[model samples]
Target chain A: MELNKDQATMSENNKPQDPDPRFACEGCSVLLDVNDGDRLVFARLSGGAILKIGNKNYSLKPMIGAPFGSLFQVESGDEGSFLSRILPVKQENKSNNVIDDSRDNRELVDNNEAQNLTGEEIEAMRREGAKGDEIIEALIANSKTFEKKFQLSQEKYLLKKQKKYAPKVLLRRPFARSICEAYFKKYPERIGFLRVDALSLLLTMANVTAYSDVLVVDMVGGLVTGAVAERLGGTGYVCNTYKGNSPSSVEMVRMFNFSDKVIKRIVQSSINELSSAKTVSPEENNQQERVCNAEININEPSTSDIVEETSVTAEAMVVDIVAPESKIIKAPKAGAKASKEAIEMWQENGFSSLIMAAQDQDPWSLAKDVLPLLSCSAPFAIYHQYLQPLATCMHNLQQGKMAINLQITEPWLREYQVLPSRTHPHMQMSSFGGYVLSGIRISTT
Target chain B: MLPTESKKAVSFKRYIEDGDLVIVYERHDVMKPVVVSEGDVLQNRFGVYKHSDWIGKPLGTKVFSNKGKFVYLLAPTPELWTLVLSHRTQILYIADISFVVMYLEVVPGCIVLESGTGSGSLSTSFARAVAPTGHVYSFDFHEQRAASAREDFEKTGISNLVTVEVRDIQGQGFPEKLSGLADSVFLDLPQPWLAVPSAAKMLKEDGVLCSFSPCIEQVQRTCEVLRSDFIEIRTFEVLLRTYEVKEVKVDTGNMIGESHDDYNGGLRPCKRKHRSKEDGAVSLDSSSNATSVVMARPCSEARGHTGYLTFARLQCLS
Candidate 1:
């Protein structure tokens, strides 16, 4: 983990040298001379020939596997430190100049003069007629020196090898799909509509829940929403509306009317059951708060009293329902009357329910009209709007002492694919941008 | 002083020389002339080729062009035969082919295996590498690509060391076919991961294996499949860009002159005229009268981005 001064210096010096000479031999200072058919006993590194000795030069051959420093012995002298001698030295025969005739017709020379032979020498003799004890004796004489050098070479080789082939591992954070899958598996019911902006909030919420599933209605872009849903094994439905191009007030009323019809078909029966429950006294604020501990409203309601108020009205006519600092001018308009009658009819049938208003629409007026018809019914209302208005409405509703709690779910921009060719031809490119809101009602029993 | 623009006038000139056209003919089985005359046109189901058009042009150029339609004129480059060579299987892309040639560490006289030869694209590259002394034993399961590949080799005049054979590598490994005698082996197949074991048998000790796969899943599978047989597996990708050339001027003064022209020309000239009238003399040359064309440089956009590449070295037990 740490480097010493000398080791660091050596490491710095080991940077790659230019014009790398190939096949450098460890055995000899003189490059092997192979062209003269001298039958070199030791193997030379291929292409290792860099210097010439006497009158001959040798090219390094691949056969010599030793490092450059091992083959040649360096001896310091008065002149300089030069290669004194090559290992497994050969003493050339100076006496045998003439051929001799014998039964084998081979010239005989003294073999005793041959010094310690190298691996290269042994291989060369094998190629020639020299065999048996002669080769064995040459190897035996050189074994000690060879072993010493080989061990040193091997230690250095292994250190270099480790530096080259060390195992490397890198870690990265998992993608969105992986995160969603991990959280959704824990609390499956909490996952709601899939949209990009909603998913971003959901991801943040997952962190808050310690990766527990919590309810989410994503109003983000379609593709990202779909991908998130797929990761969670849930369904995603895109709401078709451009948030920037909102409908007129008249159109808004029609949409609210349609929503009322939808609520009748979906939650009317449940509303009746909750309305028929034995009415508790309005003095149970503290006890009710204890029951809905985890259901703390994100916004302050306008109502001052935190107790339930009951009033049953006989007429299906319009009435002004007043709250603290706010008034419901058209209390029982056509759509409002229908919604109120639907809630009352459900209360007559006995069902528990919750009503969630669509984005950009008022939920208080509907709540006020319906509450008068079913005062014994505990109705929960939820709506989404810009932060300031929503917070103000919540404060007024809380001050007025209405039996309603407001939770602020942030508005999210949803992306939809628009046909560039058909709309906005000047900007002939498809892009996504639009905001929508969604809120959930939690029934307090 | 700035050097004057150098201009040289070129004159259109043509020269004609007399030469003899030697034509060699070979007898076909049906008695048709195999080698057509210099003036004769060779006709096939696809198109017609004028023998005369090819006589004067160098190799690799399209021999015939009628109307505006023309096929690529090609010189007899190694790549031409490599492209047109017959194959019993899928061919390697040019990107993978170039990479393998560099990775195998091949040199002249190396004995190479064009194994599992799908389409013979890699085989032709191998043949070109080992040419003059080296040889390529291309093996394939399909007979059609092999026969056509052999014909292509003959046409390219590179019959040396390129032996095409029909052999199924999966049923019986290439070791029996090659007899453990090749220096290098290149495997390009759908299941090269499966063929690695067989390639091990054919490759020499310290030999390399270059596998080409398009998908990451295939690469991962191949790596897992090759783990026991090879080591030092590395992945790489290459991108190629061809640039268009255009002349550009680096002078900033030209831009400054254009911007300041109206103010300097109108105001400075009028002021100078008033001063000249006061001095009772008129001058012709003025800074406001100067005008020059600022030439814009032409340039071409670079083309092409070749896909990813992965490589692994074979580690043999000594």
Candidate 2:
């Protein structure tokens, strides 16, 4: 009864309580989706923060206090162009009905004479402060083939022009799904091409949930770490174990906007520290913690430098920019050294699950050492970009009789267009996301 | 499968005790959920196994039967439970379950609502994702199935996180008490379009709703209804292709040699025999020409079509 009381109080303290939980408060991280996923940018909300849309900088001040999922559009005011919140007008489902159009694109050639409006005239229209819709209307009025095209073709033409002229920005909450997708699209190599489906599989296969001690080897830039911490929700711990003296950079954890309670659950420890049989003296353990702190402090500046470089590259590609705030909001840093008590508790009672996403690392080598850290009956999942490594790893584990129910899975994800008369599988799909090796660790004795 | 109550957290101390629920793993494809009682015995193709023999051993360890045949005792997880649970109805599998949970964006402290809790397969995962503070309100039309689901949740130690009720959600809709309180809602009904309004009313602004349908006709009807109150509506079919791995010996030598071509099959059967029994030396070392390599191929039989998952976000209109 006493132990239960202690745990109840501990969990109560870990609950993420905020005054306004779902609103986009100042200094909180937000994901800005531009033009219906044409560009995705992660930015901190601040009064001084600016987003560059179409070579024009707009203050993010109005966006600060708005609820998530609010849509913004660019408008030219007397002072300058600014982002203004626009309520989406409810439209009927016109795409669900089949269109029996007699028109064809055979007569429509890709001739330069289709539009009579010149570039200079369009620029003149923009300078005169015409709305994006008005410009689109003027363009359509001047186009020779606008009325001759099929219904779907005309809609497509209008959408293309709308995107270049007036792009919409959607404010989204930064969850694992969105963060993983943004990274997978912008920098797949940084996250080892671990697709969203594959990442979800890893979490599910490992059985990560509330109040479970999860051990992870997250070499894929902290996407796995952040994802695990997100699920744990400050109730348990997600200990990220490494092999060498320097720990892997989990810089991606900052993007999830995790609370301080959730951030505290994400800690790092070296493989030697976890596997060491000997207990450390109180004095020595304190000194070791100090050294770990020093290492983290030394690694801080470089990681933030990488963050800036990444955002700049995103700017070059899709204008995925981050506004510089006047007052720095230091996000509570994650990935501290595991506490001596926590590490010892894990050593005594093995972790409930394990996940490894070490890119280019041999799965067998890592599994041989890490599989023992999980309690018998604990499930594990290993992700690799290639199948050969996982195949070899599964073979060795079977040979050694260390695990049971071993199976390698490749997640096949296909999206559909889902329109009237056009509902079909997407023309282009990701053929290969990655491979996973999953099983339950078992005791040999 | 999840330790929602603090008292049950001690059950995960890594040891098996009496009254514990364990999965007896016989092979990759065969398993069963067994409750440990002091006097009960499990008889399988292996042999008769006494429950008393498994009381003190750690989970994931092998337990031998009276005839020396053994099986591994595994701790219960939601995934394992999905495979072992009695299928009162056709259920959702891992691929669809994982994708739905992720796409719904379930976190630790978010309220979720699910309908037609079929076999409690996906409901178990839902309970896992929303634990401690959040709750999962699951409704089913069948009274007996609801009772069974309640019993299963109680056995799995996640009853506190999940609440199963008997209600005809498609006919009557969800209870009005839960309106505008859910962060996400899930539906797996025969005519999900009938419950789309209630689902929309239950979700908060920008909350997500997912509907699972096996037929495109049902999906078409559901999508049409969802278009009124939801945006970014998308449909996806996610499946997993499992691979079978094996180590096989392959001959690496060229087949174009004149001596090799002389045989009718273009290659001679190189037999490896022990030259000396005492020394165990091989006469023809196969390692020089043949190598053992681990190779993998897709399993011949797999789940081709489970269902199409239709996901949408509630329009953020105040």
Candidate 3:
């Protein structure tokens, strides 16, 4: 409750909410939940060192009790004494550091058959200076039915105890791969299910590497931007574009904690500004847009008469898309003659790849406007949670014969709880890895 | 626009230059990497393509042949090289190659080892992934195959990035000198279990490893051995399905010689659901005989399953 008050005020600033990843040590921000097998999720821990997971707050690094992932309850003021210990966090993140090849499979028994000690007795044993593994082994060895539980169940019991008493949360040397997985797992709907596997495919397919320029329009947060920036290894440029008041996606990019040298490579512009010409006043901005559309249509090879007919139908469709509320949001009320210069600056520079994953915009119109800007034969990938929008965009772009090897695919993944003589796929895993529509932009001319 | 003109940062040309090896991509099913020697003629069904025409152009150059047939001369990035290379044995495609590169966390300065080079398709990709600073040591039991793969690497200008050796990795294991310095190890051989122990020995503590296998049984055997000294064991089957989308205009009843209602009137509910009003005009005329709008659809065929990639990290002894 004390930390919750701090968050409400901190929300106003644009700085990243979590500072844990920025530090090599444990947090003054962002407390991550360390589960069995080192699986991690966001469980905010900040001021007062309070960690609340579903109404239960576990005081971590608590001197008197166990550790962060340790299962224990504490009152508001009661936590101060334990937190003062402030033991330094464990630095290494090797999940398999505790190699347990000695455990054996067991048969199941009734709950009554298993013996357990009271919490006070366990606490007494801790006061006697028993380390994590010793206490855990002692508990297991003392359990009357330790040899009676099924193999999987026995493994589960050990994992639960391990997580509850582990000395600390999993400290990580955060990289793009780890950060993407952490954030996506925390907020899947917000990040648009851009799984690490699928994101990797996008990076590889777009050929994003060192010393290259990539145009990125991602609404799935800055997962793409961060991933691309890291791949370049502090070289090349990423043209980052956004639509809202500020880039909502930049939130994720900031989490990557990249150096200023790498961050400098990112050039940012607004979608409204990039789609229109610069040096065009409020009066001419709309006209400049119309002219830009017409200029691009010149490559369509359609007759003038046909274009006029198409223009009318396209206008109707555009109007249909604009709800009364969104119309106001979409309006170009701000004068943009200055931005015309900005738009020209980008047009002069070439992009090796185009990547997009936005939920709010029509992918067809967005892709058509941008695909031509891609250097000829460069790759472009548009990711969407639903396939209908990408299919529509592919249909529109195919009319010009400007792309080949257009593909929509989702990589399938299975996690196996690999153990000696007991390896099998996890009971339930993700079947949907999201979908990616990728292709190479080509020019017949 | 600012104060004194800032010196423009002069840079070297990174794009395709003359006398470079680039893959000429004709289509998804057809591609070949060629040495860009000026005046060389590439005769194909599209026409006789002159190499001089492609000089000074960027990679992914969409150029025409003598008779005006078209092809894209793409930079021989390992992914493109994998597609266009002539196969000497069963090869890995871009799907598996990309997954392996990412899962293994291959970065600059990371030393990677691969066994049974096979056609050197995947080795090429791995080399490009860990280039300039990192190295890829690939071992093949067959001496002839190893020699041929080494030649391919030299031609592609990545001989320095990857070193090919003739050795039976599964039978004899990776060389003893490479004991524990590798950042990652990859196996593409039969009976990868036979080499898993050696791979474990070569890795730095917590080093990553990946194995490509077509059969579940092979993956199972590999996993059984990896369990003793590995964590985060997972498998992936990456598939790429290409769809060709094109719009077909249907008469809404008035465009063609027939009435617009005549088309929708005869259609059942299922067929009616497929038709939508033309969002854009189809032609110079107000409308064609087709009263319907063109919509995209998947082509008759699609590329299917490639192979599975299994990844694990060597356990750090405590």
Best by TM-score: 2
- The candidates, ranked best first by DockQ, are 2, 3, 1
Which sections of candidate 3 miss by over 4 Å?
A: A1-33, A36-38, A42-146, A150-153, A164-169, A243-248, A271-349, A417-423, B1-17, B56-62, B66-68, B176-180, B240-306
lDDT values for all models: 0.34, 0.83, 0.61
Residue-level lDDT of model 3, residues B1-318, one tens digit each, is 000011210012325556777678776667887887876878888888888888877655578887777888765555667776778899987667767887787765579999989889878767656654678999999999999999888887778788999999889999999999898899998899899989989987657899888777788778777777775577766665444333334655543454445433433321211122233333324453443344434434445655567888765432
Candidate 1 vs candidate 2: which has greater lDDT?
Answer: 2
lDDT of 2 by residue, A1-445 (tens): 2433532344344432562556666677888888888888887777666777777777777776666887888776567667777778877766534467878888898869999999999988888787788889999999999999988889899999988787788889899999998988877898999999999999999998888889999999889999999999997789999876677888888888888999999998888678776567887677567656656563765567477646644563433234464454657888888998888877887788899999989999999999988878889999999999998898778777888878899999998877666678889888878999999988877
Off by over 4 Å in 1: A1-63, A66-445, B1-39, B42-49, B53-74, B82-90, B247-309
* Of candidates 3 and 1, the better by TM-score: 3
Q: Model 3, retained fraction of real contacts?
A: 0.26
TM-score of predicted structure 1: 0.33
Predicted structure 3: lDDT: 0.61
Candidate 2 residue A282 Cα shift, in angstroms, is: 15
- Chain A agreement with the truth for model 2, given as TM-score: 0.89
In candidate 1, what are the lDDT values of residues B1-318, reduced to their tens digit? 000011100000011111212111111011111232466665543366565654544211223444423332222223333434444555664444544564564434567876566666667666645544568887777888778778766654456658888877656667575655666776655666767777777776545566666555555556665666554454444322211111112223444534343332333311211122222112222245433221111112322323334454444332
Task: Give the best candidate by DockQ.
Answer: 2
